[model samples]
Target chain A: MKSNSSTVKTRPTPWDALVFAAVAALAVLTALVFYGPKARTNAPLTCVVSVGGEVMDHVPLASFAGEHTYSHNGYTLTVRVSGGQVEVLHSDCPGQDCVHSGPISRAGQSLVCLPAQVVIHLESGTDGPDVIVG
Target chain B: MKFSVKKLALCAVLAALALGLSTLENLFPVSLIVPLPGVKLGLANIVTVFALYELGAPEALAILVTRCLLGGLFSGTATALLFSLLGGLCAMGVMILLKRSRRLSVYGVSVGGAAAHNAGQILAAMITLGNTMVVGYLPFLLAVALITGTLTGFVVSLLLRATAHLHLTNQSDYR
Candidate 1:
């Protein structure tokens, strides 16, 4: 005698297909919008550093060739400028996200350290956008 | 059709379980691991999945709302509460619609719900921050949602299989 049991099916369904398509579309759209190429210029670049929403220092990327430390509100961020690029070398923030954000040399690029309330942006001669979507 | 004392009691228990899971998940230093501000394992979603299947949509929504409120009050900030409320409502809505359709397995419905949850939170963040830059995080958040949702759905499926004869829901009346 065979015992009866309800078996749960594990096959893919139409709904699964729809979800895959939707997620795929969203991924593609986000990549296009955020990772797409921006207008590049040869204008002189400067790194603008702000702490707690107040501008603290502005150093030209070309002039700064070593590490610069910014401390505020019991937090410290080590920013390194090398080869015309600026990057967060280290941060005391628990998440360390700013340090992992890599380097930025392009105009309009920014690295924000939320824990320390630090915002570093590379600006060019051209006026930046009124509002950067990302 | 009628609310039974047993159903109410079960819902209350489930809500408590969900709140416990929510609080427990908060103890982990997830931000350090994920490097995202609001990302988490969302372990409480397990209870939401179980409620959706064992009780019904309305019951599941009740559990979701109650858990979010209590969890917020217990170990979260006002902004966290706002995000969780928005995300929970959107996720519950998606899961209910998908479950009603009966075309998707629990896994698919769970994934859809999780993705919708992230979308809702992203929308909330965009509104609060007054910048579309928040939208940049959507892709990463959705990817994480898919993974965590699948895990939660798998757990729910196992529970459903093990308790098939418990008659968690009045199938004839509700489903």
Candidate 2:
């Protein structure tokens, strides 16, 4: 009730308390809308790790351009990048969210296809998130 | 209740503008591959946010419903309509909540709405496909959501600022 009063004063009356309750309820409901059946179980997620001596400076289309692969959940993605442009050449995942992403060229540009558990991001600048060892 | 031709006309005009902006955002052929399903800039949500704060829930919903239904009909493929409905409803609900909390200005509402829209769409896709692999893309989608959401939020905030004085009177009954 106190929160309601404070909210009312801070906000407007035309949009009232019941509206607030309903919205909160909706937020919870939406968050709980999980997909996939628990019965079948999910495939183990496996991702390839490439450790570099130095941080990536730019889009490495030349070095990793031929083909790149990533596996997660139940999907696998194979991508091709040429001359600083990238596209999903093949994917085992259905719905083709990866194939639909087309390509990425800019330094800050990124393409993520959820169905295939693949992400292609162009690393910017010389410095990036630091890796720590215990 | 007397009919206000002027009010209806204004809503219709805003709805049209929203629809037009939505179509324009798709013209850019640039696509980035992120590990996410159906990621988008959500430029159209700016208009929905504007309609909500400048008008009210019902009017904003009217704009949102019309835009989602018609926009889908015009540019969307099969199953896109379903995704659009889920996205639009999620966006609207977020906007209304943020507006009530006073934590969201028009711009904030726009950002929240856009983020929610993407989340809703991804959820729909996952359900249809019966896959949890899609969930791995959630983080990447959130990243795009942040960028586009902020942009749309800033745009709608500007719109609300220009029309702050205009409010729906008792006779108009935006409720």
Candidate 3:
């Protein structure tokens, strides 16, 4: 084989360095956005459940103490609301991505089931912002 | 265009290698390490980078599409197939552009491809979930893509060097 000397020179060129630096900058900005401070609220938690873009049910976290199941078109989603938190306890979706998403407790947080077209968003009050302009 | 027997054989071998690497990667239980759904090491990209450099753009695309289809059939669901198709196509497009530009090395081309793959996957997720919030995962995915893409690119560089003497037919046609 030809001497592997050519491969040794495959060091990062100026262009490579520029690209890496740009990506690093993006990473830092994204990290800031991802780990940035959030608006905190002390009001009672309300979980809004929607299916097919229509509001299906609304439950106060403090009042809900047990598991609630919602079914649509043979697909089932079990939601648990307890201790001021909401989560998808179980789902019959093929990937179970919803169930694995853990829980949502803070306002503006949401749990979505794509297969079932279900979305559950946590809010502090019923009259709060429809969309959190961040 | 007519492919010579040698070129055809090489393409088949590269496609098989890409498929094998993809399959082997799926068996590793990577979720334990990454803890994020749909994150992958993208090992098959090694072969892709090799094919891009050695066999040219069109052949590399052929290898990529064939491997994705077969890999999807073997060990993935329909959703997985969709994600792979989108991701692979995006990656291939970026790699071809970078390679043709000749402004960056193979490593840069691979990194570009990997990042594009992640972007494509995020786009797929956003559309599938009907939620724009899915884009929140972009930074983490891009970071992972940088690491994995660089590693795969480095390996391809090594492979190209080691087999530099192999004079396959029509190798010079594209260059």
Per-residue CA lDDT of model 2 for A1-134, tens digit only, reads: 22222322222244333443443444444333322233112222112222122222234344555676666667777777676567777788777866877876533345666664456665433333111111
Top DockQ hit = 1
TM-score of predicted chain A against the true chain A, for each candidate:
0.64, 0.46, 0.63
- State each model's CA lDDT, in order: 0.79, 0.60, 0.78
In model 2, which regions exceed 4 Å deviation? A1-134, B1-3, B29-37, B165-175
> What would the per-residue lDDT of candidate 1 be over residues B8-103, giving only the tens digit for each residue?
888999999998888888788577888778887888988998888777778888899998888788765887888889999999988888776656
What C-alpha lDDT does candidate 2 achieve relative to the native structure? 0.60
Residue B56's C-alpha lDDT in candidate 2? 65
> How well does candidate 3 reproduce the true complex, by DockQ?
0.24
Candidate 3: true contacts recovered, fraction: 0.31
Clashes of 3: 0
Q: Which ten residues in a row have the lowest lDDT in candidate 1 chain A?
A: A1-10
Which CAPRI tier for candidate 2?
A: incorrect
